[model samples]
Target: MDRTTHTPTTDQSRPLPHVVVVGGGIAGLAAAARLRGVVGGGARARVTVLEASPRFGGKLMSGEVGGVGVDLGAESVLARRPEAITLAQAVGLADALQPPTTAKASIWTRGALRPMPTGHLMGVPGDLDALAASGVVSPEGLARAAEDATLPRTEVGADVAVGEYVAARLGREIVDRLVEPLLGGVYAGHADAISLAAAVPQLLAIAQRERSVIEGVHAALATAAQNPNPAPVFTGIDGGIGRLPGAVADACRAAGAELRTDTPVASLRRTAESWTVTTEGGEELAADAVVLAVPATVAARLLAELAPGAAAELGGIEYAGMALVTLAYHRAELGPLPGSGFLAPPVDGRAIKASTFSSNKWGWLDKAAPESFVLRTSLGRQAEEAVLDLDDAELVARSRADLREAAGITATPYATAVTRWHAGLPQYPVGHPERVARVESALAALPGLALCGAAYHGVGIPACIADGWRAATAVTAGEVSPDLVSGTK
Candidate 1:
């Protein structure tokens, strides 16, 4: 089924090798745009994107709510990830980027929202005095955390669950009360499943090198403090996260990459020098190289026969479902919200795992007269499947109850938008590094094929762009380097 090369009849001039990018999500689009620019210039290489959905963006979706743009999926990029920033610059949307209005965050505990202690990075504290003064943890809990400097260190491979590692280094209380809930909100995953190396490697690096989580954090913070320039916390676009995908798509079109929507890929098979990609409508596409940029599960099905080993490894990767319920209400309608956001411990039997004061947290978005508030409540986590079983009405009701009890918000929201992401967030399970190594090793055996997505490395928007661009770069270069693609493994 694999053809050495493909030259469509409509195409003029010498038809060069083609690069077919599967899935129209950001990863796919990024790869297509990059490859078209670098390899065929769109006209020569014949880059065609085969998306399985009517629209692009995958998880980066935005829509108007009460005449305001609301992002329904993957939200902001941190300034720390420079790859996304560079991609934005390339797409001509660098000017649209903006930092989070405020870096302030909080935790929902004891039916109240309290500010996260300063100098704390993902539950690892650099300032012990601040941790003690923040009132987030008990005195005994604070003492236990400080004692991490004296506790014996555990040496293990890079593949380990974040929850287990954090608990071992710090304590179970911190893992459950702070790290699990706070970081867990990012993936909507169980701490026990998310890999420490793949998900939060910085922490692992701290433990491995410094021998103490606190000492490592302090050293890192000192390095940051010494830097000539330091970046902010949360990074986003001025308009919204939606601007990123839109800008990327525009750049792809300008680069001569053809984008087709309302199309779904049926299957794929590898040829001697190219791949034959079939669409749901029975049309077949030919390409010299292909990039599978969708979810791991989708990639597994597409590469089942052509790359069975990689497909099997990809299929083994797990994902968690997520639902975002955005509720807007007048400031006076709710008594008062004291924190930017709240992360619920797993012990809390409530359906909501986290909630953010969207409008207040971002100064520019707080345009409502009299200070109207927008709250984004999240439901479902890796270990909490029952939350998703609740019907929409029941889900909203439960969320409202949690907010009312936690933040004293009794007023009904004027606008409510609920989005459910099934198998939305990728979970970097233990031994993920080995699994990725296996998949990438298998992919390397194929000279031109590559796979890119949040399923591999960091799930942030920037990481996906980095993976996509790298894959495209390899195709254009006609050869791929292991270090470039196999970053960790």
Candidate 2:
């Protein structure tokens, strides 16, 4: 059940299927859109998306901050992944695709801000000299990290924690100051708990091949440098990355799909030749296939009766809550912004984990607010939910204080906005690969039933889109046995 190894087989002769996608997030929308494309015209598959919330997009949201349009949720997608970019282009967002203006980023640690070390992958330094020159790691820490080459190879059985593995090879300073913040920004989970095999599978594979972690990183970086047409690492829509979901939803609807918001799914049951998906309002919809694309907790609740094993594994997955405090100030108040903003590692004892200079990073935002300096700071992480308890005003104040301490800016913001995401990010802990395998295996028994989202494959937009596409392909290909559809398996 290796997620990387399994591939879905397709059958074009299968009878037209009816797909019911639960949850209206990017994953669900992507599934519906792809399903339509696969089935084509002439009363193929009838696709329906049911969203519990009033809005279709899950974390992709847009709002006005200080009279300027801005993203309140996810703002960018990694351009390296073709899924998101391909989907965007397919949905007519090709003209809107924009790359960040700045690539520089700094790390705030050990009492000062310093440029992030070059030749590193997720904080694992490929060039030791570059890391030492950056001054992010102390002399003692640098010396300890240099010893990695001489030390015996550490055995990584099955899976290992990202921090534990890196710290063992390098030093604790690298884990605390470098890896922690970068990894936190994505998973919102502590490095000591995140699974290296699941979070960074490439690194895990390299670790298994090379004796030295440094050598492994160096080899990977070298390979990346050889790419002829290297694309930008990240990209965003002209308006905002939040616009992606709406565009995808539109495409889904255009393909003859019915989308319903404020309709939470209450239960799921299997019947002869079809599956019954009951809504919270007591309405039932029968479908040939069902895709559970909601949060892991919600999916678990709905699948408990149909797939108890998958439900148990889904229930075990944890999530992290986070809040973003976006503040806008006059350009005159903050003369110039440095880098794209800085990441404050937890070891720095700062309330804010990271800050992105929206005005400096994206040319569109700068042009939209020529007189304003807009930036957003993120707070809270896995097991660090105390900041979420504070009121929006208090959170803004704390964010301002942290910004001032980090970048000597004291001017009061002309406008401020706070967006709270409760249990937004999924945590991938050690042995997550095995957990995913178990979940997939259990679902395999219940044909026409699939799951996809940040909780599975990956948390990035591209990964989610790929997950959705795969699920749609699997369900529509008549891969599900008729016996399973009739609850006989």
lDDT of 2: 0.86
lDDT of 1 by residue, 148-248 (tens): 87887778675678888877776777777787787787777877877778777877787677777887788887887877777876777765677777777
lDDT agreement with native, every candidate:
0.74, 0.86
Model 1 Cα RMSD, 1 decimal:
3.7
Candidate 2 error regions (>4 Å)? 1-15, 38-44, 478-489
Q: Pick the candidate with the highest TM-score.
A: 2
lDDT (0-100) at residue 483 of candidate 1?
28
TM-score of candidate 2 to 2 decimals: 0.93
Q: Best lDDT goes to which candidate?
A: 2
Task: Tell me the tens digit of each residue's lDDT in model 2 across 1-489.
Answer: 101111122555565577899999998988887777722223336788999999988999989988989999999998887778878887889999999996588998887779989999899999999999999999999999999899888888778999999999998999999999999999988999999988988888877888899988998999999999999999999989989999989887776688889999899999867898988988888788999999999999998988888999999999999999999899887867788989999998999999999988989999888999889999999998878999999999999898888888889999999999999999999998799899999899878888988898899888888778778867876332221112100
